[model samples]
Target chain A: MSAPHSATSANGVPTLDVARLREDFPILGQQINGRPLVYLDNAATSQKPVAVIDAIARYYREDNSNVHRGVHALSERATAAYEAARETVRGFLNAASSKEIIFTRGTTEAINLVAQAWGRSTLQPGDEVLITHMEHHSNIVPWQMVCEQTGATLRVAPINERGEVIMDEFERLLGERTKLVAVGHVSNALGTINPVARMIELAHAHEALALVDGAQATPHMVVDVQALGADFYALSGHKMFGPTGIGVLYGREALLDAMPPWQGGGDMIKAVSFEGTLYSDLPYKFEAGTPHIAGGVGLGAAVDYLAGVGREAIAAYEAELLAYTEARLQEVDGLRLIGTAENKAAVASFVLEGVHAHDLGTIVDHHGVAIRAGHHCAMPVMEFFGVAATSRASLAFYNTREEIDALVTALQDAQRIFG
Target chain B: MDLRDLYQDIIVDHNRSPRNFRRIDNATRMAQGYNPLCGDKLVIYITLKDGAISDVSFQGEGCAISTASASLMTEVLKGKTEAEAEALFDNMHRLLTEDAHGVDVDELGKLAALEGVRAYPTRVKCATLCWHTLQAALEEVDEPVTTE
Candidate 1:
């Protein structure tokens, strides 16, 4: 196959017009603290476009009905809309079938599903579950729960100072006793894009299953589940410009077919008697009750919006923005940039001497530059860096170089004030 | 009314050159407090003589508010009796959470500078981390308490 073109359009036109994209997201146009909003918190949650919001609004206005079992016309329409969302997500991830995709609350719930269902069933008392040091709390906590419940052991693969996963150490950690390998496709705190394909192959070599936390990666990069050889993949829709409360978990059909249902309530049952109940098959088996219908539809709309802009184009544009942001931030005095990985998304985690991150964030916000402060939910990463917290500015494709300049200027002001 | 007022000249001075910022050679009571959320680790050592705070000191690594709070706390509590220190600490806690419509701070002493922190909801933990640590030390509580 020819090298995949990274430009916006098939005809080489820009996929997302920076100005037009800004218009699509109404939140981007608002003013915060008397300054125009410069949103650099995309790693937390990208701003939703009018298309996604309207899609959700239209769902509740017109097609508001319970799905799966309803025989009425509204129910049929709602069911089709919901199932169509599954197909959209399946296509988005390039999964083999829609049955392979299960919708959960978010990446956290999806990971818990795999850990409780597959992990609890497969992992023995002495088996080891390996994860990297840079994993989010969601990925780490569920595996820890599995380990605690099953008498299994948890092993951590270390990362270098640059926040890149040490592949050699990860390979060394994988042994015959390793039953599962859970790793993130990208580090949320550091923005390091991990070599997950290699990590998955290593897990396979040890006869273990690999679950990729794509919460941070799916929005920034093109993800093909088959190409990555990921046995299981979990992603939050909100991170990918979709609505919150809707996420996707893609499991290989055979693997999902073999595992037991994670939760039991309304919809995940085929037959129920006082004696015993037979579970429903595949995706439906995992979805326990009334799903987030409008959220799912909004997620489908998000996929549609992104597909219109094109994934490769977004990736290239974000790469340029990341480079621009790094160069601009490098000019700030007494500023130390964290997570200097060779391969990373558009996240800049930094600390300024004599200025607390909370103070820095507040001062920056006075200029309407929104960045994240605190542990960024990766306390281990903060502890490794020996700082309480660093102010993080994460970008999306919709972000522009002008916004990065705004952030730099804001940081300069913060330094002057806090110094 | 900018929150920057919270990081006042006094707070900055205290943060830059904290009072009693050292390990006590001999301590009557010592307790370590850690804000795992922000990674602010503090070890507070107190020298008490007959229900009076004879000498108090602390050493830790954290943000400006936390370090400055530690310094001010040590400075004010060092020469006071246990009852006086407890009352003052309680007043400081009230200054943080209680509605600041109009509260007199003639009794708060130097802690009045931290009044600006009440405006920003997120930094309350930073201001109170050291105070809570001191409370834990005085009460002889061993369990690590996270202020966040």
Candidate 2:
């Protein structure tokens, strides 16, 4: 469900007031290259709204203290804010308990946490880790490293030309020896929203655990990890209009309790001594040392802001915008879209016939159109498409169709010069 | 800065039809260059005769800046001795990265058209990657030259 429902909200009003919402993001009002900035690089990292910025600043200004350590008033406030952020993330993902959510550096670290802590402890020499062709390097390399260290084999399922996982191939790759199945909830480079719900069911049927890379998906739609039955779901807050360096890893509570701590430090231990130390419980067992307290506060505000705007409304508006983008891009001469899956987020990756992707990126950038050009940390996808690179224009809910028109004009100007 | 200053007409022409864009069957030396940032790769081939570079060619896929830089490089370094070519690469380096007043333009010739790329700090690597590859070809390095 890209749109999930009709274009109207439950009250029959238009789902998203993008113009009013745009005002909250001050960066969107700026001018670059002597023109209005049409930011289309949300897939890399989104612009923060005033609420998130104020929350972070206010935390540092007033509640600046290490959490879970001090007994004073500021420490209590900091601890309260940090813990509440965890609860916010828990509710955002619809997890059973806040203990299931672990505050990590970002999605990359979250995946690495599972790969090192869970994979190293559970995997055996003959076990296998199954992943797809469309996975970002963060998902692929962590699993690869874990497999090498644990002597577990890594298997990759193939994707179709449309940059989608072939369900049949994916199922065929699963087996009794498959210990884990890692897949991206949405392809960052291609924007193909995968059928992760069905895939999780398939993985469970084979008695294998599943991890969903929800870094790209959480910014666009509501993620119910409980409903999806996902054993692990990793996401980055920066991609979802939160601050950088804060992300969440949602894992089943039982699975987390069984795993050893990935790192050792002050906050993660209950009793440290010359002898063996007793580790903390559940989430804190994994989060070691002094965490980014202010970042957590900011992320909480980001979650609150998105909840205020409504994820369903954001999804619907972006879906319509994506449709408009795809249609307008097709009108460009000698331009070809790379990912054409039936369902996708608001991401469009394409290559101009005469110009290299980097050239297009540089050209459009001069017109104040910011898009991503390169492998997008998905070299495997680039290899599959047989292209050196592709320019990607990823949109958020605040993006307007008029801004999309500006992108088209810049791209056309590039064509004229290169042609 | 203006986009025209970055994508000048001369650089555009060279990119559209690169010169010496071929692989030498048997060459004195060969080295591969890669811009991992952009997934751009190029191979520089050289042949020497009478203590001077007799032929030079390159084959690769990159942006207009990289392709034009490599194409124009081969055209200028055709008959220069090894030392002369090295000096020219140094000059090209200064021209792309240093202040304009610091560049000695005596030997830059038509290659000066690429001076437009100096305005873009990020694309500076695209303009200089070919020279690094050429430097590697003249040396004993076995691995590909990378602009990290």
Candidate 3:
């Protein structure tokens, strides 16, 4: 496959015009602590572009109504916009059909939907649900809940010191009894890109379904659910420069058709009565009630904006930024970078000598550099690394080398104060 | 908020070398506290003699603020009755959470070092993790305390 036009540079290196891209996000222009804001917490939630924000506001102002309920003009318009958003997300993940895409609150909700709907029905008492040590809490906790409810066992696939998944161990754990394999496409805490495609193949070999938590991966790369052949793929819209409270769950149509509805409410029902109620068809069977209409619209706009920028270009630019960030961070003495994986995204988690992540986070905030300081909702990874917390600077395409320099300077300031 | 105010010398000093930083044997009461946000875990133990806290200690891993707060709490808790310790906890809670303008710094003594925690809303939980565990220990609650 050829690189997108915006991704290719003269020297065969993929590059993005980050300066022009920065103009799209107005929040990046604001000042924090009397300095220009340097947002590097994209893993937490990305700053939305004007197009997405405007799309949401436009929906609320121009077409605010309950979707799929009323036959009126406003409701029809809102329903059209909401359904269009699903089509946009379907294209974003390159799913085979819109029927496979289910709108959810976020990745957490999407995972819960799958766990409760599919896991509860499918898992037996002795069944095992395999997950990695590097998965975010969203992926871990939902399966835990399912296991607790269904009397199934939860197995953990270990990661090496460099934070990459030990695939041999992963395959060893995937036995005939293993019912599901839930893994993150990218580690939010360590930025370790797991070998999920091969892992999925291994799961399929063992007759276990694979669910990819694509929250961290969707923003940084081009994800084709059909190409990956994943049983289920989840994404959070907010992490991909869309509004909060909206996400997508792409499941195989066959799997989705077999799984019962997760929630029973307004839109998920076909014909309801006191005696019985038939569930709706695929996608709607999972998305219950009047959904986050504006959020869906905003996510659709975000998809358009990302496509305009080109996902390949964004991924390439972020890869360069990650390298630049890692090199710059190394210049700071006594700094230890965590998660030294061969394959990584634009996340840099580190700890400075004699400085707590919390202290570093505070000091850096004063310098107007936003970083995530804590376990990054991956405590198992922290325990594995033998640290309480690590300060993380996660990047987006809008971030520049200068912002990384600012982050390094802030770390130096932290060293000066705590040294 | 000034960073110096939060990471005052006393707090930093106590963090470097915490007092009563050990696991107590034959404790009258004990409890575990966990702050899931930052992964701060601490176990608080107290020995009571004739209705007074004869000795107190803690062991765990946490950030500087949490470690120092735990250390300071252990120091002040010794030689105080359960009622007095509870009152002191209330005072510390107010001092750490509320405005320091009207609070008597002299009464707070070394604990005033943690007064800057109120400025960082997120860190307030870190500073108080041990105190909550201490409360749990005093009440003899078997379940672990968590700052969720």
Candidate 4:
């Protein structure tokens, strides 16, 4: 799997050997609809590498046992592996300690935990929880639920036509009454890379904490919670080339200590009695009952695989791939590209002149070009764009330029059929 | 399995120039249908008089299959009694969902264009969205119908 590091692009950046990278993802080798699969739906959920898949299988085959309580050798090994995975996650996010990392089912559960545990305890009536217009349903619904329960207001910061958050509006929304600002590090629908570090600074200036939804960002770029000054960061393991049913919530140690546990069960209890029960410390306090032990181990292996490939190289390579895709898509007559933010990831949402997105998606799938076609779970953004739905082609590092060409060809075929 | 089968010439023609693609001003009953998955939405309007559908129309945005289905449905349902329209709805649903060989194509007329939807399982909802809305309007169901 060794590629020449000396094969640098003109700008001194190392180019990703995509062919070599694609070999790592076993699913990419298969066919769809009698043709080679051209998967461009990474923003929804990424394809996992063999390393993560093998790690999960290995855990189940060799050391399938309960963690923390049992004295058996298998239990000890499982416990060590699970806790070691936590440490890997801590390092992946560049968090200060593993105690701040709590495992949840995925990004949705992580955000809900904060909304219920922290928002319920801290937010007051007439207070505002700020979020952007382009937030996914996962980010918006949790805050809405929390606000409903606590009588707190949910304020939305406006985004410009390019799908980038308006700094002035965000600043205006951040005032003394704002208790928390929850925003996505990347817009899953538009591929807009938000300026979350600056947003966090603005939130802090107003005495409000910031939570970054890094579900879309973790797969494409480097995310350091400390560097971004994020009070809390949420990400899904499945979206980041790991297994489903596992995710990490990175909170500041002080905040984790102050917040009450969202769920209560065996693992979260330090000492239990009929009259009185004491909760465990940070991390475990939030992670109650049996955890997704194999998922955590798979996520750790995913982290190791990503590090081995190098995040910087992936980012750079994806930038070129995105530029190429956008250019090729522009050649298609009557194809309108959505979300042309100056700063973007490799996701492209578009609509053809006369064809409905669903129709286009169906036709494209026939050609084995798998793209997401719908509101992409960001209905508010769809409303802003004045489109009911858009066909999206989101790229990962493993995608080749040839696959993008195949997508373009499929779209052309769709146009002919609809024409 | 062919794209031509799914996007039949009749379906494309109807989609391009949908019949009765307008809201009824004196509509006695109207119901909205939405497919949240694809973001397709439509409203079915009907004027019932003497137990017969005196006037019928629809206004919405959806895929070609949906638009054409609604257009053809409006054309077929103009003089139909409430019970006749219900029977036709059941027939169309069966045509799209069940085996194509089992369907009586002679009864469907222009609606047979949508028979190709039987081959594409995911699109069965798109072709049936309008029929469902039509049923809701006839039944006077207050809640919006959704093809989940």
Q: Write the per-residue lDDT of candidate 1 for residues B12-119, one digit (tens) a residue.
A: 788778889999989887888888766778989999998999999999888778889889989889778878887887888888888864555888888888988887
* Quality of candidate 4 docking, DockQ: 0.86
> In model 4, where do residues sit more than 4 Å from their true spots?
A1-11
**Stretches > 4 Å off in candidate 2:** A1-14
Candidate 1: misplaced stretches above 4 Å? A1-15
Candidate 3 lDDT over residue span A1-419, tens digit each:
12333556788766777777788899899999899999999999999988899999999999999999999999999999999999999999899999999999999999999999999999989999999999999999999999999999999999999999998899999999999999999999999998889999999999999999999999989999888989999999999999999999999999999998888999999999999999999889998888999999999999988898888888888898899999999999999999999999989999898889988888899999999999898989999999989999999999999999999999998887766
Please tell me what DockQ candidate 1 reaches.
0.49
Candidate 3 chain A, poorest ten consecutive residues by summed lDDT: A1-10
Considering the true interface contacts (CA pairs under 8 Å between chains A and B), give the fraction that model 3 also has: 0.58
Q: What residue runs in model 3 are displaced by over 4 Å at the alpha carbon?
A: A1-7, B50-52, B146-148
lDDT of each: 0.88, 0.93, 0.91, 0.93
TM-score of chain B of 1: 0.93
Task: Please give, for residues B1-148, the per-residue lDDT of candidate 4 as tens digits.
Answer: 7888899888888888999999899999999999988888999999999999999999999999889999999999988999889888888888998876766788778888898898888889998999889888888899989876
